[model samples]
Target chain A: MAGEIKCNNCGLDNKPGAILCEVCSEPLEVTVGASVPIIASSSAAHTPASAVGIIGRACGLVVGGNVIDREFELPKDDFGFTIGRTDLDQGIIPDVDLTKFAEKVKIGQDVGYTVSRKQAIIIRRMGRLYLRAIGGAKTMIKPQNTDWKELLKDQEEEILVGSRFRFGGSEGYVIFEVV
Target chain B: MQVELTLGQRYLPITDEAEVIFLLRLLRDSQKQSADLALDLRKILDRSGSMDEPADGGLTRIQALKAAVNESLSLLRQGKDRLCIVVFDDTMKVILDPTIVGDINAIKKLIDGVRTGGSTNLSNPLRYTLEDVKPMDGSLPKIIIFTDGNVNAPSAAAEERACLELARQANRLGIPFAVFGTGIDYNEKFLKNMAEVAGHGSYFEHVKQVGAMRLRLEDEMENLKSVQDLDVRIGITAEPVVEILEAFKYVPQQLALPVSGKIVKDEFPGLDVRGQAYLIKTKVHAGKAVGDFKIATIALSWQGVAGAGVKSMNVVVNFTADEKLISPVDKTVRNTVLNTEGTKATLSGQYNRAQTLFTTSGNTGMAKKVETLAKSDEDAKRTLRTVTVTEANKGIIGKKGAK
Candidate 1:
């Protein structure tokens, strides 16, 4: 019995079954994994059309000001990258998606974003997962039964989480979906 | 973040004069390698609505003044020139205290923010300025009052009395107040009186000509001349029977000319002379037109470094049987001083020498040369020196006084 609702704090419109607002960490009425349909209100229709394309690979999420936007230009070669305002667009993901599913995210769709200096690696195949397991097994051979050991995938790289950082060498949180 | 530039190029930060003074000292010690002479500039700016009146410039009169002030500050790259601003309507407001103008842009913004609206009040600002500017004991302090029109100032006699009292106070404190009137609408008589009472001098000019005024005021601020006495009385000799019309002092402070026409002269008793310097346009008497001309002599009683003493200089003017053909003797004297090869050569030589010193040792020998050249020029040597320094100074001294 899911119903539509808005988050009390931050006034972010969310699904009735949602537990929290994605924009701000405010509690919502809907519970997690609720089967609710989040309807966009008439006022939401007035939202300006965002020009930012879908983030196909890893994209950085910029949470500045009340309106959150994202930069889409991906790193091409082994050179440094800078996020320009020209490359970004404002986006908001419907609250229903956040409350319903954590895994099996819809591709090419906007999702809740956090401004963290972490990159999410695209899981292409089982072979790469297998390779990460092998690398983790060899690096910490004396590790006991801890899921933490399995978390160290071969694709995982060291990352410095601060205001400024190098792109390639560090493993930063990446955006899987873009709107 | 407001900056108040004194005498144009010298920056005076409103937030902290001591900080600016320290910075100036540091610059002089490290870069300029000269004495850490600090400039303490106290400015009284009129904020009456009249200043907001549309002018030929894109902005209003007040806006132009702000621009001029900022332009003046650009030259103070390294110096102990402190700036303070007194903004006034009917009442007075100290927007930026007499501090070193650290940032001229900031001062511009602060000045720009001064919207024009209200009656004129010269007293409050003058009073505040007199109280605010206190130099480092021996340092020189300067107070500059800028206005557009006459004081909506409380009645003439009362205002005059109050201004005189203020001048006396300023005299006691050794602070000199100089005035710059922006437009013709300004009551020259009142401003002149105020300037006299403030123990300084006043000018009447166009707002567009403020740059000239700035130059004259800056000269006075820099050297901080010890005005031994003002209102130096000059009497004419009884021979030539010359009728003096008017006289102006060419102080090298800013503006096209210092106190235009007879603004400052009214304060001093007119020295009726029998010389060529005094030639009235109208005839005194119908038959007396062809009579002998008399010359006027200004007796200057100055308290020089040596002691108190007096000196008399003659100003002669001549009138022919036809009063229309009257000529002033001072004009000839000035022309002689200006066009003469010896005087011109001596002055140019001294100027070149000063320039050489400036280039070689990075010193302001120009100021010293001016002080030296003023001695034989006139009785009010420093005042005249003020007129000779910059375009502003030239304007104060009058075009005839320029050499």
Candidate 2:
């Protein structure tokens, strides 16, 4: 805890020297010293992740693509949410459960469950949010005005203001908006 | 005909030698010339064991193919359009030659009787169909293929190489071609790469589902009908002797142009109104003049149903020492460039590079897709590349080209 910065927003442990919560992009407290470093990281100083969203504004989600019309609110206060199919016996329960989205979805059935237990996750870093593609099945993303493609699991790319995320079987999909 | 040239970031720092992407748009008013083309179209479909598997809407993949083919035959004009049918399993079999579409019932009956057989043989069908796609009665031939399995004749690699060779031949012949890879079993990258090798008027599609194949084929059919006799030759020159990096036919469908030189060039055979815009990459030198300067020139000529004409335009960008004058890249342009570069990486069998490019381009979605495919089978990796590249190019030019 000495070197690590604890974000006042979400409680995920962040890498050392992080100016914002890696999970919830809220700014961590900085100490005033006699000699300030030449510069902080440009993003960490200029546009904290919270700048893109209100302190408590939730992330909007819309699920489509063969799945029934389903919408849910990803609360800003929670650590984060996942998009994946559910397998209860394996203790695999996604935050934004794909199987629960609709009974019409084939992903929930026994035969062709292509969606992984944990496909993608939305979180923040140094006051900026990002989407990390993870899970057993394939994951894809589409920014506003662009066609659907797979999601990248990286630290640099941030989620655009209007973007959609899809994973798992054919019926697995979710559109994301930073409201 | 109209030609306009634009830069990703209009202002370049005068001090540093810069490499920038230039967007070129070609627009034609085709509404007044609504004359339809007399087309010679050929369909090469795969009838392997996998074709019988259940797909969307409870119909078999073969059934979906038949329905799409039947619907297409009904729209063909008897005298104006001719249709050819070929099926491949262990070997290529011709069901019909370039025959005029007279009775829809007869053509449908022929298609309905084509039975599923042995393993997929891609190279033979592609060669047989593309080798003889000469214009009949002044009607240009359009060869469209649909397959749902990998080449199993000798091996996938052997067949893929053979197909690419045949595609190069078709490219030299000015023949138009399109291919659709249905279901997850097919080698999408090989088919796409093969078609792209045939250059002008080549289209590729990844039917993610067998059920969706019908709609995609139908959509492509409409696109084919709309493709009139628009033969275009484009000649582009850079002022400071820039390196022509890459060019893409950005609208309707995203296909990379084969460009190599200080002066870039491209051609099109029977282009459609739905797919006209282009994006080109160049490393241009900014002179010390500082203010506004002309960097390039675009010359375009086309012969279509409306007649033949030539048009040209000058591309201008600012060479500024003032950092304030430099503008951030336009979002649409940035996305397109990334998609193009990512696709290039995928085509070259560089999955990691493709993933990185996609990640940076803001479509992290494709990055993940590439990552998963990067760890799979060789053929599966090829599919990932195919879908990754093909899917990335969708709607890149927008409806009206980049305004």
Best DockQ goes to which candidate? 2
Off by over 4 Å in 1: A1-179, B1-37, B77-79, B153-160, B199-403
Worst 10 residues of 1 chain B by lDDT: B19-28
Residues B1-403 of candidate 2 have per-residue lDDT tens digits of: 4343445666655633444656665543434353366767788999998999886667888988887778656557786788888999988888988788787798889999988888988778778777664567566577888888988788877877888898898899877677877667776667767777887767676654454454454555555566553678888777764556667775545666666555777787655544455777665544345777766778877776657766777766677767665655544455566677777777777776777666655555566667766676554554564455445644332121110
lDDT per residue (tens digit) for residues B1-403 in model 1: 0000101001111110000000000000011111224556788888888887765436667777776666666545334567788888777888888766577778777877777778777777778777655665434466777887666666646655676688778866666666666556666556654555544333322223443444445334433322322333323222223232222222322211122222212222111110011111111121222333223333333222233444444322222334233221121112211212122222344444333322222112223333344444332232322323222111011111111
**Would you list the C-alpha lDDT of every candidate in the order shown?**
0.36, 0.61
Best by TM-score: 2
Q: Residue A65, candidate 1: how far off, in angstroms?
A: 71
Q: Which segments of candidate 2 are over 4 A away from where they belong?
A: A1-179, B53-59, B122-124, B131-134, B138-140, B152-162, B183-189, B251-253, B321-324, B342-387, B391-395, B398-403
Error of 2 at B157 (Å): 6.6
Per prediction, fnat is 0.00, 0.00
